[model samples]
Every structure is written in structure tokens, then in C-alpha cells.
Target: MSDDQDQEQDQDRPAAPGPGELSPEMKRSNVRFALTLPLFFMIMFPLCYITALHLPVPHDLPVAVVGAGAAAFIASAAPALAGKFTLVPVDTPQQATDMIFQQTVKAAYVTAPPGQSAHMLVAGADGRVMTQLVPTVFAPFAAQAGNTVQTVDVAPLAPGDGNGIGLMFFMLIVCIVGFMTANILGNAAYFLPMRTRVAISAGVAVLTPIVLFLFMGAWLQILQGTVGQIVAVIALGAVTSFTVGLATTALVAFLGKWALFPGMLVFVFLNIPSSNSAYPAEIVPPFFGWLSEWHLGAGFVDAVRAVLYLDGAGLGGHLLVIGLWFLAAVLLVGAAAWRKRAAAAGEADAGDEDGEGDEAGPAGAAASGAGPERVLLGRVHDHHGTPLPGAVVTLVDHRGTQTGRTSTTDEGGFRIDDLPTGAYTLIEAAPGHEPAARATVVDHHGGGGHGGRVGDIRLVAHEEEHRHRAAVATDGTVPPSAGSYGGS
Candidate 1:
């Protein structure tokens, strides 16, 4: 047979495996991924729950003290109750009542003159645990003055939500639904553009909260608030859902299938424990208390409590936290979309330079095995020579346009294949480090299968760079230039 005929026959045969056939590496990766969930749940559930929930010790719980001699009583009691309670002395019972309604104090202790029982004003809306804990802690203190404590629920929970924790559970439900919807969209409808995905997420956020509100409020009667307050709570829920959905979707787009780990880590592990839902932040460990200050779940729960029970006191601060998270999520999704577009544009521009057009595609002649593959290989490392995995390497052409990009693997290795032979500037960047750049040339006659190795590229930490510059400035000497490189 003629050589041309033989070549044509060989080309007719499939060069790659069938669509249903999974590579051995892919199979192993899938198995490992499936096994990771139970392990993650086991570790995170205990770590987050136990550390935050188990043996909660209230630290500096604010309790307003009212009536005459309140200041003197607190002064005497302050030493023994050093870390447990912060006694805020108020002139009258009205001030203490106002503080409880405003959520400035968890509860208030009103001392009677002598024989009459002292009243303990507690907000059931602060959760059943706080209501019970306040009286228990203060009863002995009241007894020392020859007076018994009488507990009063100044701001009680809704009749249907006897425990007062239903709002927090509601917030958790909304958040889970929000993020899960993003997961579905990421996996099932990934072809949708970023704008479309965001719109769909927004729609889900708005609708899901309304549906949940109907079930948790209208039907169940668990929620208690005016029409405006109810609307505000619903808005907070929508914001929570929208922010979480967008953030999770962005993570999926950026991290691919492995996004679940970080997604759960942020939304579930850190968020739920720090939410101050089951227990207030003052009662929990300090780590969770810190998280509660800014976490999404905490913001949602706090906002709901303010709207429903606290007469909107401190609502703005809680909303601000949620707003910041929303802004961050929007920025993340925008950045991911921009990166995707830039990558596609780079590939298209590279294809145009190769004169490949649509038919030849991004792979160009290399796809048809018509020419040797022009590839670049490199490893990224820290100044200490430790491999910097997940570092991004970008190749820019002479025209200052990005042509290729790839991330370093577990071993800090990266490869950009099927490139056109040309001069390029390779930039390696990792978080917390200053980006390193070097010039290199890829040629048809390059080493090993027409590809070139850029070797090890090291990045210095930003602090090190700053310190070096400062030291040079202090010495009255010019800082050394960032190193230069020539074509390989």
C-alpha cells in the first residue's frame, strides 16, 4: 500500500479512549474524593461542635444592675465575679428594661429594698439558655443580700418557638439551601455564563426565603414581628442566601470539584459554630466569639434577632457584616469570570497568531500531530527551596499579552503544552509572596520533544522584600534590583 493510504487508514482509528472509559488516575481520584466526605464530616463536626459547644463558660456577660445601692453591690461583687459578669449599674428599673429590650445587656438584676423579692429582667428572645443561665448565676448573689430572685421574661419568644432558637435554625436552613443550590448549578449547569448563574442564584435567594418564611412564619407561627420587621428578617435571609450561593459558586469555578472542602469549611464548620445560635458568643470559647463578630451565619442570626425582638437595635452593624460578605462574594465571582475570559482570549489570540482559525482550534497543528509540540515546563518554590504548590504561572508574549497560564501541582510542577515557538516572559505568583518573572524563549529545536524547561523559579515573601527595601533605605544605599534573567 502507498504511504499516503497507510497514513489515512491509521488516522481513521480512534487515538484516545472512549467517552465512557475513565483513566486509572481519574478512577482513583474519584474514589479518594468519595471517601473524603465522611472523613471530613467526622473531623469537622467534632472539632467545631465540641470546641464551641462543650462546657461553655460565659466570659463577661453583661447584666444591668438597677435600684439604689446597685453600684455598691456591684463594687463588692466585682472581685469574686471577675470574668463571668460585667455589672452595668443603672439608676432605675426603666433603664435596665430599656437595656434588655435594646440587647445591650443579656439580662438585668433589680434589687428590692429588703423583704420584697428582687426582680431579674431577662429576654427570652436572647434564647432559652441565656434566660435560664442568668437567674441561676444571680440567684446566689441575690440570696447574699437576704433577697430571692424573681425571673421576668421582658422580651419573650414567639408562642410557637418556645425555645427561641427557631430563628437560628431557620438561618441555617436558608444558608444550606443557598450553598447547595450553587453546588447544583455548578455541577449540573456549569455551561451557564457567570451572569446567568448569578441571576439564577439571586432568584433562588429571593424565592427560597419567601417560601421558608411562609412555612416558618405564616403557617408555623414561629416568627413574631411587625410587618416591617418580618420583611427585614426576610431580607436578611435573602442576603445570606445570595451571598453564600455566589461565594460557593465562585469557589466551585475557581477550585473545581474539590471546592466542597473549602465551601463546607467556611459555611458549615466555621460559620455554624460561630453563629451564636445554639449559644451566645459570650458563653462560648473565645475562638468562636471572634468568629461571631464577622461570620455570615452570625450576622444573619443577629440581624434576625434585632428585627424580630430587639426593635431593630444594633441591626445596622449586623447588616454591615452581611453586606461586607456579599460584597466579597461579588468580587470573587467577578474575578473568577474575568480570569476565565482572559484565559479564553489568550488562547484565541494565540490561535490567531498561528493562523489556525476555528478549524485548527487552540491546539492548532499540534492536535493533528503535524508538528512537534512546543511546551514549557517549570517548578515554583519559596526562597527556602520548599515547593510552592498552587502557585500560578502565567506566560506573556512579547506584545505584553498573556498567552498561557497554569497552576503548580502537588510537587510544584506546571506545564503549558502546544505553544507556538516564541519569546515569552514567565511570571510565577503565590499568595503572600512577591511574584517572580523571568524571560525565556521556546524554539522548535529546544530540548526534549521540542519543549523547554524553565527550571526552578523562587519567590520571596512580601515581608522579606519589604524588610530588604527598608534595610537598604536605612543604610543610605540603593536597594539591589530584582534579579534579571535571559532567554533559555
Candidate 2:
């Protein structure tokens, strides 16, 4: 390096920073960012209303009615069902479903030629849910009439779809969400200050999946689906994690760590329960029913349920919601990163101005301005020097804009950034390990405060066997054979 360049660099700074080291001005400019908080309600309300709330049952939905008695006799109950569901009544035995290919009726019920037991002919072309509806609705009528409704499938489901396609589709999306969250959080922990963002990100990261997973399983027993549903939840965990990670990073890029709360409320509290996976939202409480609008879980679940149950009548709206979220998040995150670069350049320019002024000699300038606040950021690792992945990091100030936040780190380390000079409760995320949030006092007021350095902030990932045991004891069982983070 030339002496001239070296002198110019030293002249610009009160102190020289080592390679990869961050300066106060640099932190101030790059650390803070802002962007649009999606108008979730506005985006999803219309679709939720049209398909979920509105849509009258499609009419003459080719329902094959197979039973005994005459035209009015077998159909004594048809008028009642038709009042609600548009049912196509196939009159005779042989001619009942001759036009099945004509798409006239979806199912056919043929009386067993006078003395023969009644038989059913169902079209295999329809969705699993739509196909099942025929049998489910017809059984009660046969029971009331003292006649058995014997069903014969003219068509059956494809083997691959035995578990139902919609269920698998939802599982795939959940997997996408999980990986997306992991990568997003990992990026923030790397780009921002590692120490603070780690625990907070990890905290929100892990809990988000756990919360969504447990709800879909415990609150709604949709987890008990056929062979297909058995491990479907595991995939959902992946989806939930990745999708949340994307939102988290996008939010953090713009809003910083506080983005975790809104992310969860957007994906979890709003999406999962109201998804109407177990029952139609009409059956659930009205307030809780709107989950389909604001929550991704609910939105995907609705889309999957439609593909599986609604015969594809209502998928358009929910698909639109997911598409918008993913696209918008990608753009916002890109913009936020761009802004950081711009801000960093601005700070660098400000430093150059200072050097020029100093060389020109001190003018009789008496004006005073506060210098940038120093932010403390560091990585948290175990004593073993391994990345304490999935750790939570938190940051708060006196005003409490950060009143509630808990985030987790990705497979790397932790970071906490954008903090003004203040005392902070720096917490780490260890599921069962309850480590008190260590405290730190930043000193950006360099000339008047302690020293040039911001402050000392260090944390170690705690190993708590007792807590793990307690968690198992309280739950009366251990986690699956999967690793601690709920995996195989």
C-alpha cells in the first residue's frame, strides 16, 4: 500500500478499524431500514369471501343415486338434498350412467333390476373430496328408509392420489417455508451483528414451526390422514420454517429484528387454525375463521383442501395470496439490501469530508452535532467453537418498540444490530436451556463516555440436560427420534 493512501485513510478516522471491522458511521447508515408492511387483510379478504364464504354448492354435480322404490320413492329425499346440493338424479338402472362420459352426471345409482340390491356408479374423474361427498350424503337417506345403500364404484381414485393430492401439495409448500426461514435468518445473522440477532431469530425461528406443527396436529387432527398424512407434517415443518425465514429476513432487512412478531401473526395465529382443515370455517368461531386471509398456513391449507375437497372450485384466490407474499418479500428484501449499500456509501463519504476539512486546517467553526451512535454486534458460539445454530437473540430500548421479540440463528452464529447507545437485555435462544439475557451498555458518546469501543457482549449456548429431561417429563414423552430440532 502507498503511504499516501495509508495517510489519507488514517486521516479520515480518529481510530483505525481492522479488516472486517465495522465503524460507528458505517453501522448507523447500513443497520436501520424500513419498508411496507403488507396489507394482508386487503390482499386476501376478497378471495376468502368469494370462495370460502360465498360459493353456493355447484348444481347437478352429477351425483349417482342408487337405491330402491319408484321415481318419487327413491328420490323422496332427493328434493331435500337438491334444495342445498345440486344433485343430478339418474332414473333407471342400465341407462342410469350410460351418459357418464357425456359429463351429464358425476355419479349414478342404479336399482338392482327390481329384485336386485341397489348399486352405485361413481365417476372416478372427480376429486377425492367431491367423490366422497356422494357416499357420505347418501348413506343417511338409505338408513332412514330401512334400505341399505350399497355403493359400487364405476371409477376409483388413482393409486398415487390414495393419500389425496391436496394434502401432499400443502406438505410441499410447508417444506418450502421451512427452508426459506432458515436461509433468511442465516443471512441476517451473517450480515447484521451476530450476537443480538441470533437468539431472537432462533427463538422465533424454532417456535414458529413448533407452534404451526402442533396446531395442525393437536388442535386439528388432520395429521391422522392415511398413509400419505403420516409423515406429511414433517414436510410441513420444512415449509413453515423456510417460508417464515423468508418473511423474517425480508422484514429484518426493512424493519430489523422486530419483524419476527408480525411474521408469526401473519403465518401462524392467522393461518393455521382458521384454515378450516378439520372443519369448514362456518363451523368455527367467526373471529377465528378469518385466519384464511392473513395466515399462509391457512391459505395453503385452504388451497390444498380445495384441490382435495372443493373439486378445484376455490383454489384461485388462495393461490394468489401465496404468490403475492413470496414475490413481494423477494423484492422488499432486495431493496433493503440495496439501501444498506447506499447508506454505507453515504457514511464513507461523510468520513472523507471530515479528512478534507482537517487537512484544510480548522476553520473557526463553532457549530456542534451529535456523532453517530455505536452499535455492538458479535457472534455467539459454544465453547467448542461450533456455531450454536437455532439460538435466539433479542434487542430492546427504553421506549419498548422492541417490547416483544425472540429470533433464532441459522446453522451459523448470532447477530444483534442497529441499536442506539443504551443498556440492553441480550437473550439467547435455547429451547429448554433458560439462560438469563446477559446485559450490555453501549457507549456511542465516545469523547464523553467510557471509551472508543462500543461495549463487551458475549454469550455461550447453555447445555441443560435437566431441562430436556423436564420437558420430556412434563410432556410425558420424548421428542421423536429426529434430532433435537424435531427431525430424523
Candidate 3:
């Protein structure tokens, strides 16, 4: 209670953070993780879910029709249905039933006898949404014929699998785990070699499904599938999801943090809603329905459902979708790794040049007094990283001042000498290649230590570069902003 006690407490208290004390890295981390990620999830999660589920109406849904008049009735009423049903005429009800079992059609419409109710053979195993939708779609036709429509679930959902959505939820969980696991591995173990990361991904892919199968299948009994069946579906789903994450992470490695946009757009936005897990593809929009045919989540869900209830008739197609995604991801990650290695080698070469210059006696060079020149050195490479010769290189200082202009020699090397020390923008332009801009910093401690290295400038081929290049043909007017690939 006394002044002495207060003084002792003040001494024990922690110091406040000083002004500008937060490192740039810390600020960026908070902005990306604490602020951005939470906001993104909060906004996108609800938006994606609500938008995907809201007002789902059938569009171009294929159905098999039996009997002489059924196909004609569907064709006549198709306009009123907003092109919702694509009716395929079958010779007999058995043919329609076979098509439904093969998943060639979502449902089968059997024409009723005169003065009798019409029967619609639906597959509850396709999805609760689809099963429910069939009746709604056919009710009008049945009404026009003065007959009530009866929906008979030809392929039924498993026990405890309420409305057949259990499998969808299971697929969603597997996808989330698979991608999130890959992301965690990519970030936490980023310092490790790519091959090691890939191996780790494979191991995680194997282990995660095993755990999921035990929990969701054996322990929970929510998924109605045999042990082997569950294991296969889980494995395929995990591997596919992990590959998605790996590809996103590799993009970050190659294109830097900004690549997260496309990655999330593809995997989360475009992939999930279109996955046909939340709603049947037939009920959702045409775009989503199309995506459901090949998207990883949809493929997994289809495979799981087929194996569990449809006797695995069309499982291979879904499995093929998963495999293709995995292959594309592997290729993307491989390309990123190659670029990383090339960039590192370029840096090493630049560092070696600086070392050699340093060894050439700074005192003697200082005596030469060549107008305090800040030398800019770098090399140009094509998309595959082959050195590009005859490339034009230009430099502009931070103050919008243009300076050193040169061209690459046979080895894709260029140098600009005799410039005041400051920040600069380096631009590489070559015919048939996209121009690239790199920011450089030139700091000279008086003496021949006036070395400013721009390392490597990779110019993607015109056809391959996704970004639009600025006009580098002008008087060293650097237009494209310096981003993740800043050279120096």
C-alpha cells in the first residue's frame, strides 16, 4: 500500500511494446492469419454454403422413360420444366431400370396403364435431394394424365444413413482433413526438401484415411460400408484432397503468397459447392452439375456411394477423377520445385560474382573512382529455365529516374555499370517472352564494395505467362510492379 510497494510492483511489470516494435513478418502474419483468414472463412463459408443450397432447381437432368407415350409426354412438358429433364426413350421398363442402376440416368419414368397411377423409379442412394426431386419433376406429367405419381426407391440408402447425406458429410470431412493436412505439412515443414514433403504427404494420406475409417466407420458406424470398402474410399479421398493442398502450397512457393487466391477459388469455392455433397448435382446449377462430374469431392462422394449401395458399377470413373487430380497436383508441385532450385542457383552465382569482386582488392578499385558506379548484374531465363540470350535489360531508379540500359549476351547475362547507389527497378524484355520486373537495392560502402546484384530474371514465354506485361519498350519506364520475385 506504500510508495515502496508500488515501486517494487512497477519494477516487476512487463514493459510495453515500443512504437514500430512489431516486425514486418509479425504484422503480415497477424494480418493473414488472425485477421484475414478468420474474416475470409466467416464470409466465404456461409456464402458458399447458402448460395449452393439456396433455390436449387433441376437443370438438364437426364432421365430414362419407358412405355410408348412416356417419352413424348416428357418431350412435350420439357419446356414447362425449364429444360430440367433430358428424357431418354428406352424400349422397356427393364432397360430404364438398368440405366438407373448404371447411373446412366438419375431416375426412370414408367408410364402407367389407362386409369392407373404412374410409377417413378428413383434411386435414394443417388442422394436424398435427387430422390425427392424426381417426384416433383414427374408430378405434372402424372397429373396431366389424370394419374398420381408414385416414387419407388429402387436403390435405397443404408441404415442409419439419414436421407443418404451421411456419405456426403463423410466425403466433406475427408476433403477438409486431406487439404488441411497438406497445408499444415507444407507450412510447418517448408524448410524440408520437396521430395520429403511429398513423401510425408503420401504417409499422411495413407494414415489419415485409416484413422477416419476406424472412427467414422468402425467406431461411429455412421458410414454404411464394409471395412475394405470404407478403407478404399477413404484412401482415395484422402490422397486426392492432400494433392489439392500440396498443389496450393506449391503455388505459394512458386508464385508467393498472392497465389492463395486462385488456390482457394479452385479448391474451396469452385470445388466444394459443385461437389454434389451438399445437394445433388441435378438440383444445383448447370455449372455446379458439370463440375460435380469431375471435381475431387464430388468424385469421392460418388465413388463412396457407388461402392456402398450401387454395387460399384461406375466406381472406376470417380476413381479416375481422383487420380487425375493427384497427377496434376504432382506436376504443379514439381514445376514449383524446379523454379525454386533455379532461383537458388541464380542467387548462388550472383553471390560468387560478388565474392570474386571483393577478392579483387577494393582499395585499388576505389582509387579508380569510376564515378561511384553501382553495378547491376543479372541473367534472363525462359519458362523452362533455359538461359535466354539477346534479351534487353533496363534499369530505373526509385525516383522515377531512368539509368543503365543493356542487353543479355549469349549466356543470358547483362550488366549495368556507373550509377548512383539507391533502390532500382530492373526490367527484362525479350521477343516471344513476357517481360519481367525485379526490384533491386544498391548500397555501396565507398570502395569497390559497390556491388548491386539483381540475380535472376525469369521471363515466361508469351504463351505461358498468365499476367499481362507492361510496355518495357519505352525509355526504361518500368510499369509492372515489383512483387514476390524481386531480384535483389
Best by lDDT: 1
Q: How high a TM-score does candidate 3 get?
A: 0.65
Query: Where in model 1 is the C-alpha error above 4 Å?
Result: 1-15, 353-488
- Report the backbone clash tally of model 3: 0
* Top-scoring candidate (TM-score): 1
Local accuracy of candidate 2 as per-residue lDDT tens digits, 446-473: 1222211111112233442221110100
Per-residue accuracy of model 3 over 1-488 as CA lDDT, tens digit each: 65456446545644322222332433465476557666777777666666777887887788887787776676777677667778888878778877887888989888876578788988888777788778886887778877788888877876666766676667666656656655655544443445666777677767776777677667766676676777677767667667766776576554334455556667766666787764778787777788898888788778877787778878889889988888888888887766655543443344335323321122322222211224555556663446678888888887777887888766666667766656677777888876666555453211112234444455755554144222111001111223323222
Report the lDDT tens digits of candidate 1 across residue range 139-202: 8878888788899987788888877778778888888888888877775565455577788989
- Ordered from best to worst lDDT, the candidate numbers read 1, 3, 2
Cα RMSDs of all predictions? 17.0, 19.3, 17.2
lDDT of each: 0.70, 0.43, 0.63
TM per candidate: 0.70, 0.37, 0.65
Runs in model 3 deviating more than 4 A are: 1-22, 25-35, 255-261, 357-488
Candidate 2 similarity to native, TM-score? 0.37
- Residue-level lDDT for 467 in candidate 2: 15
